[model samples]
Target: MTAVLFFLFAAAALAGALGVVLSRNPVHSALWLVLTLLSVAVFFLLQSAQLVAAVQVIVYAGAIVVLFLFVIMLLGVDREETLSDPIKLQRPAAIVLGVLMLGEVLVLAGHEWATGAQTAHGVPIHGLMDTGTDPGNNIERVARVLFTDFLWPFQLTAALLVVAVIGAIVLARRSGERPEDPGPGIPAAERARPGSGSGERPEADAETSEGTS
Candidate 1:
């Protein structure tokens, strides 16, 4: 059962990672990244690292990926227009790096399998240990280690979150009070007054002729 679960989680993690790399849309990439994070948490569960799994979900899948999505949306980039150019170098470079990473992972997995099979007792040394303690104790151990040993990293993560929140707010805000509308320039009284077609003009002409005679 454990072996089956391990294989399942391993496959899921690899698939999710591939999806992240292959997805062209940034939003889709972020979604695939979430999947990858979740699959990694499953891997952690298979390894009996429950605290690590919880943090994996909370810090990565929940916080980090959501922030990524927020930034992606806030940017409002037109993916089609941006990616229209052909002969781009990034795609090939990414593919090469991905292949290299996959090869490395395969090599590591093979090495671990060979080492595990060659063991005399045929028992997994790093398999789940019977800690004979409550799950709460495990949680407490994680908290203690995080606060004592990993405090700097934890605080740095908090600071990163703060920056993200501030950046999102700034990006989402409208530029300013939105310039006031400049209405029609003509006054209402001038617009309402009637224009003289011939009455005032002809009278003024006749008075000018009589005064000249």
Candidate 2:
């Protein structure tokens, strides 16, 4: 039944989200994120919104998750960090915000259910729902509403994303300017010239002794 399928997908999404938070390795976290995104796409499918589901799967699960994995792998950030919290009151603040968001969602869901409309908690909040059409409408209607009704905000979002991308690039370049910290496998002396092999310093010492003798 649809109800059973909905619960199953919802459970999967919740589990995946928890896995993303609890997994120590960044790569594992990214995989869990893919699971969560895929489950959300399934939610769209259950609502008969095939286009949204396909976009969710392709853009989020496929491209975005792969990009996350690539960054974790390439940047050598797969290792776990210390468990100590860096910011003061961060955990308590996050818990408060999460509780507030959950309360808001519950209230909206209850309101929509009481209204008995297929609005899905006022999904297209900018305008009224098109009760005349079935749930299987394609993305054309969504696109039209986005461009016509929300064009300025959409353009602002695009500019913000562009600024974020530039900021990330600048940060990455700045980080690269600093010398890399020594890893467990690297000796303090060799960290400066990791390419010079493990015997490099000893060979230099031998050469200096021979020259003195």
Best by lDDT: 2
| Per-model CA lDDT versus the true structure | 0.66, 0.69
Q: Which stretches of candidate 1 lie above 4 Å from their native place?
A: 81-136, 147-213
> How would you encode candidate 2's per-residue C-alpha lDDT over 112-161 as one tens digit per residue?
46567765655632212232363434577677778999999999999998
For candidate 1, lDDT tens digit of each residue in 1-213? 677777787788888888886787888888888877998887777656778888999999888898788668767862743555477787879789989999998777667464574544455524454333455555687788789999999999999987765554444433224543223442344324423232323333344323432
Candidate 1 — worst ten consecutive residues by lDDT sum?
194-203
lDDT of 2 at 45: 73
